[model samples]
Structure formats: C-alpha cells, structure tokens
Target: MSLVKVESSEGITTITMARPEKRNALTQELCDGLYDAYRAFEAGDDQVAVLQADGPAFCVGADLMAPPAAMWKAVPHVSHALTKPVIAATQGWVIGGGICLVMTCDLMVSADTTKFMYPEAKVGVFGGLMPGIVSRMPHKVAMELLLLGEEISVKRAYDVGFVNKVVPLGEERAEARRMATVIAQSAPLVIRTLRDFANQTLPRGPAEIFVPERYKLETIANSADRKEGAAAFREKRPAQFKGR
Candidate 1:
C-alpha cells in the first residue's frame, strides 16, 4: 500500500500522508511517495494542493530507527518545485522535519489541539533544513523552537502568523480544503506568476539553495566508488571506480 494518498477534484488536489500507525513518520518510501505525489500534482491539471496527514498527529518527523534515504526529497521546492501553491492542514504534534514541511508550504491551517515542536536539539541530532523557518515566522520565535527545542501551542503559532487558520481538532483538513478550493478558482497563470515571484523574493536557506548540489554529493557519498576510494586509500593503491 502507498504511504502517500492523492486525490483530485474540482481543480484541487489533496495529498495526504497515510501512515496512521506510526503517526505518518517520514520513512524512505513515504518520502519518495510524497516527492512523486507533488511532482505529479505540479504536472497535472490541479491548480491547488492541500497537504494533510492521517492519524492523530500530522507527522512525527523522521523515523530515527529507519530514516529516509533522502528526507529532503519530501520537502517542497527542494526536490520537486511546484508552480501551484500548497496548504498544510496539521493536527497533533508536528516536529523536526514535519515542521520543515509545514513551514515550506505557502499557507497552513492548524488544529486547535495541535502542538508544534522541534526537538532535534534535545535528540542530539540536526538536519539544518529548518533555517527557512526564520523566513516564515518571527526570527526570535523560530530560533526559540530551533534552539530551545520547546513546543509551540497552536494559539501562539497563530499569533506569530505561522498558521493562517485555526479550526477545531478534526476540522483542519476541511478548512484547508475550503481554502484550496478558493485558490483553485483563481486564475492559474496569475497564481503561478505570483507564486514564482514570491519564491524568488524570499531568502532561501542553505538547504533550499543547494539542494541540487547536496543531492549530487549525496549520490557520490553513497556510491560504491566512494567505498572503493576509501579502501584504496587505506591500501595505498589506485581506486577502481565504475561510476556506479
């Protein structure tokens, strides 16, 4: 079964994370699924997208025990740039990379019961992908969550302009759909032009700016040639790289 579920109607596309059992943890397959879904959405006739997740939590970030091969792929504009806008509808806890995902979206709707947190500092690991949060919300507030690793309540998130709408616990997705429908009715060319212009005006973080470069390095780092090079260095011999 696919971890990501996609549905389209009335020029609106709904992309959902469907890993309720694990609170939609970003596994390798799930990341790939999300990338593929967004890429398809970009190419399809859909004019707007609503991103939501199944289960109590929107997402719990990476599965530390079995992290994705390329978590960045799941990020908007990083791997799959979309001309159309995406709105996130979140509930429960959104942490770490989950926060990254929501922050990248053009707009967001949070459940009244939701809590946003970035615990990478407490977990003793960091992805450095969340610096873009500073561009989305207040610099100091973003830093507080990034550095102190504390939870931000839904109300505070709204006050800080992180959330566009705050609905009841189970109404996040509905609100997102309503917003998406409105956007879908707008002129596509103008919407695309505005989205493109807005993206260009925003300051990109290192992760967003160098995603392609990082992808190349990641490819080389995971290649057999890298292992062979290391072995050859240790053995004082020339490396035999097949460019695999």
Candidate 2:
C-alpha cells in the first residue's frame, strides 16, 4: 500500500501520511510519495490542501534506521514552493522533520495532545531544516528548540505563534478541513496571488525587500475574479469565481 494517500473533493486536496506502525516516520518511499502528492496538489485544480496523518502520531521524524542516502533524498522540501495554501493537522509527536513539515505549511492546526520537538541534537545530528522553523518563529524560541532538543507543548507552540490553532485531539483534522473549506470558498486567483506575494516578501530581509507591491496590484486589477468579487458584493450574493 502507498505510504501517502491523496484524495480530492470540491476544491480541497487532502494528503495523509499513513505509516502508523512506525509512528508515521519518514521513510524514502514515504518522502517521495509526499513530494509527489504535494506536486500533484499544486498542479491540480485544488484551491486548498489539508495535510494530516492517519495514525496516533503525526510523524516521529526521519527513519534513522534507513540508509543515510535514502534518508537524505527523502526529505519533502517541495512543500516550501507550493503556491496555494497548505494546512497541517497535527497530533501526538511532531519531531525532527515532522517539525520541519509543520513549518512549511501555510497554517497549522495542532492537537492539544501534540508534542513538538527537535531531538536532532540528542541523536547527534543537527536539524538541517532548522531554517524553516527559525524563519517562522522568534530567534530565542527557535534556539531553544534547536539547542536544547526538548519537546514543546501545544500551548507553548501556539503561544510562540508556530501553531495557528490548538484543538482537542480528535478534532484537529476536522478543524483543519473547516479552515481549508473556508479558504477554498474564496476567489482562487486572488488566493494564489496573495500567497505568492506573501511568499516573495515575508521571508526577505529589509535590505533585500526590493519587489514592489504594484505588480500584485496590477494582477488583481486585471483579474476577472476581482471584478466578480465586487459584483457579488454589490448584488449581495456570493461570488462564483471560476479561477479566471
């Protein structure tokens, strides 16, 4: 059976990690499957994506027992380039590469029982994907997770702004899907435009912030979805955007 499952309905694509016996640990095949699944979602007509796992634990990190080369090649870094919104529904252990995966998502809904950790240091390895976590969190908090390699409670994760919402254990996936549905109802073109703009601007240093907002403005101004949105508001009806 496939380690990763991709299912689509309406405008949402759901990607599930399915390695429960091993706590959904990242194996070479699983990593490749995840990368391919994300790529498929990005290229497909899905306007939003929900990433979740089908086990007690979301992911326990990389399969350290696997060959080093396989492990290295299996990291799902492709998630970083997705243009559409990607929401993570996390529960139980989210460690090592699992933490990296959470950082890559546009939003994350973590279970109250979830425990985030970066135990790479404990295992004599450094988190190569620490940049992803550092980019999203404060420097001190990032250092704590990286240097100390301890488990972080879900409440602390939300407090530090790494997690968007903290839901009861079994409710995480439902809440994530609800959020994804809300996003899916929006104008797809505008959603992609906004995501693109944020991706381009938010990670850059002040000295590197040279891109002008006028480009996005022009794109929005010329989009049919924009005009439809205005018309719908004027008519007091919901906009029916065809992603034009």
Best by TM-score: 1
TM-scores of the models, in the order given: 0.87, 0.79
Candidate 2: Cα lDDT at 227: 95
- Model 1 lowest lDDT segment of ten: 207-216
- List, residue by residue over 141-222, the lDDT tens digit for candidate 2: 9889988988789999899898999999899999999999999999988998998887766563221122124324556889
Tens-place lDDT digits, model 1, residues 28-96: 999999999998999999999999999999999999988886898888767787889999999999988
Among residues 3 or more apart in sequence or in different chains, the pairs in candidate 2 whose N, CA or C atoms overlap within 3 Å are none
Model 1's alpha-carbon lDDT is 0.90
Instruction: Summing lDDT over every window of 10 consecutive residues in candidate 2, give the lowest-scoring window.
Output: 205-214
lDDT of 2: 0.79
